[model samples]
Target: MTWNILVGGQDRLDAIASVIRREQPDVLALQELKGWSARRARDFAGQVGMHAHLAPSVFGQPVAVLSRRAPARTRSITWRLHHAAAVATVGGLTVVSTHLNPFDPERRRREATWLSACFFRTRQKVLIAGDLNSLDPGTDHSEAVKRIAPRYQRRHLRPDGSVDTRAIQAMAAAGFVDVGRGIGPTVPTEGLRQDEFGDFRLDYLMASPPLAKLARYVSVRRDEVTDMASDHYPVVASFG
Candidate 1:
C-alpha cells in the first residue's frame, strides 16, 4: 500500500521518470506541472512500464498521478485560492496532492476550507502531500525565501514571521498531521543564491490520524535525482 509522491516545482521529466523507475511505487503524485509535464509523465511511465494520469489542477498548471495499478477514484478538485487538488483512491486510501496560494491569506483560507470539506466527505483514509508554501516549522530564513514568503503563517507558532498558520491549523483540526514536521526536513537545496535548507521545512506529507497507523515509512529524496529536476526536493511517504 506504499505510494510515491512527486511535486513538479520545476522538475525535469527525465529525472522524475528515474525516481519512478527506482522506487517502483504503486502510485506517484506530481504537482506544479504544465501540460507538457503531464505528457512527459505519461511518457516516462510508459518507459517504466507503468500507468499515468495527468489531472490539471488549474487551467495551465496541472498535477499528475502515475500508478502501477489503475486508480479507482482519480479526479481533480478545483479551488479559487491556489492551483487545485488532485485526488485518487488506492488501496482503500484517498490520496490528495495540493499546493496552496502564496500571495493571499484570504485565498489560502478559502482554499483550505474547500480542501477540508473534500477530505471530510471522503470515506476512504486520507493522505495529503505537497509543497504547501509555508515556513519550515524550524529554521532561520535567507532574505530570498523570506522576501517572497506566502501570506499565511504555518500552524506551528514561531517568534517572528508574517506566515498564515490558519490553513495548516484548519487541516490539522480536520485530522491531518504535517508529514514533513514529523519526519524531518524534506527540502535540502544548496548554492550561494539558493540555500533554503538552513531555513525551515516547507514540503510535506500530511495524513489523517487514522492513516498514521498504516504508515511504515516516511521520507524525502535528498539526493540529486537529476541535474534539472527542481529547486525544491521531493517528499515521499509510504504506507502499509
Candidate 2:
C-alpha cells in the first residue's frame, strides 16, 4: 500500500527512470510528458514492474501515471484550461495525477472546482499529486524571481502561470492537505546554487485525511538523479 510520486518538468525520462529504479514507487505521476508511445511509458513501467496510464495532451506537455498494480478503473479527462487528470486505483484507493494551469488564475480556479466535484463523488480512498506550477504562502512573486527584472522574470511565468490562492484553497476546502509545509521548498531544482535555499514548495502531494494517515514519509530533493534531468525538484511522497 506504500507508494512514491515524482513531479517535474519535461525531457526527463532518464531522471524519472532512475527514480523509478531507486524509489520503486508503487505509483508515479509526471508532468511535461510527450509522445503517444505506450512502449516508452510501458517500458518504464515494465522496468519497475508497474502499469502506466498516460495522456500526452495539452499544457505542461502531458501527465502520466505508473502504478505497481493496475488500477481497477482508469479514465482521462481535460478541464477547460488544458489541465489533465489521470484517475487510477491501487487496491481500494482512487488516485488522480494532475497539474493545474500555471498562468491563468481564473482557469486554474475553474479547473479546481471541477476537480473538487470529482473528489466529492468518489467513494474510495484518494491521493492527488502534481506540478500545478503553483506557489503557496502568498500571491506575489519571489523576490529573486521578481528582481531578475520583468523582461527576464516574465519567462518564469508564461501562458497562464499566475498565482492562484483559490486553487490551493479549493483543494484544502475539498479536504486535501498538502504534505510539503516545513519540509522545505521543492522548486528551483537545485539546492546549493543560490544564497540560502531558494527552493519553494510549489509541487505537491495531497490526500484525504484518512489517506494522509497512511503516508509514512514525504521528502523533497534536487539530488543527483533529479537535478541533472530538469529545473524542478522532485517531490516524493510515500504512503502505506
Candidate 3:
C-alpha cells in the first residue's frame, strides 16, 4: 500500500495508523512524512509490529517503507535527485517510496530518469509506488484540474504545450506497469480546497513484469477512515 500522509501531522498519525491496521498490508510506502526522524519512523513501525526504513528528507518531507518482514538491504537515494526516496529489499522484491516535486515537471523527469535506471539495475522484482505529482497526459484530467485550480493548468503544462507525462512514461519504458491504471481517482475532489490538484491519479504503484504477475489486484481506498485521514487516498495492491 502507498499513502502520502500530510507533512508534520503527527497529531493525526493515530488516524493513519488505524487505517493501516485495518488494511494489514504486507508493505507500506509512505511519503510526505515531514518532521519524521529515523527514530520516529522506527517507533511507529514497532507499534505496528513492522520493520521500517526511512529516507532522510532534504525538504523535510521524507519517504519511508514499513514491512512485515525485515529488509535484506535498505537505504535512502537522494544524490543528484530533487527529492529523497526510500528503498528496501524484502522477500526478494525491491520497494521504493517517493514524493516528486509538484511545481516542476522538468525536475520530475530527471528524478524519473534516475529511478528508472536504478530499477533496471536491481535484479529482484521491483515495485515503485508513491505520489509522483505528474499525471499521464494521454489520460484526460484537464477539465478536473481547471475546475479545481485554473492557475495550475498553465503551470502544469510543459513548454511545448503538453501535459507532463514524462515521469510515468520513463517508468513504462523501463518495463514497469502502472497498476493504478483503470483504478479510480486516487485523490478526492473535495480535498482540493486544501491542495491545488483535483481528483487525479497522482499516486501509483508501478511494478516490474515479475512483480506485476504477482499482483492479484489494485485499488484506491476511500473509506471513511481514509477520506478523513489525508488529502491523498491510500492505494492498495495485493500480491499472491
- Model 3: residues >4 Å from true position, as ranges? 121-123, 189-195
How badly does each model clash, as a count of residue pairs?
10, 7, 0
lDDT of 3 by residue, 1-240 (tens): 999987744677888888888889889999988888899999999888889999987654789999999999998986655568999999888999988877788888888878888875434589998988878745876567666665677546678766668888888888888876888777762432354767688898988887787888998888767777788888999987
Kindly report which residue pairs in candidate 2 clash with one another: 102-160, 102-161, 102-162, 103-160, 103-161, 103-162, 104-160
Q: Which of the numbered candidates is closest to the native, going by highest lDDT?
A: 3
Q: What lDDT does the true structure give each of the candidates?
A: 0.59, 0.64, 0.81
Identify the leading candidate in terms of TM-score: 3
TM-score of every candidate relative to the true structure: 0.76, 0.80, 0.93
Residues forming the 10-long window of minimal summed lDDT in candidate 2: 1-10
Give the Å error, residue 127, model 2.
Answer: 0.9
lDDT of 1 by residue, 1-240 (tens): 122232443335666667668877776666676544557767766887777666565543666666777778777766563666677777677777777764555566667767876785333578776656555423444443454334322333234554445666677777676655655544444321233233445666677776766777777666656324555556666776
Candidate 1, lDDT over the whole model: 0.59
What value does the lDDT take at residue 199 in candidate 3?
Answer: 67
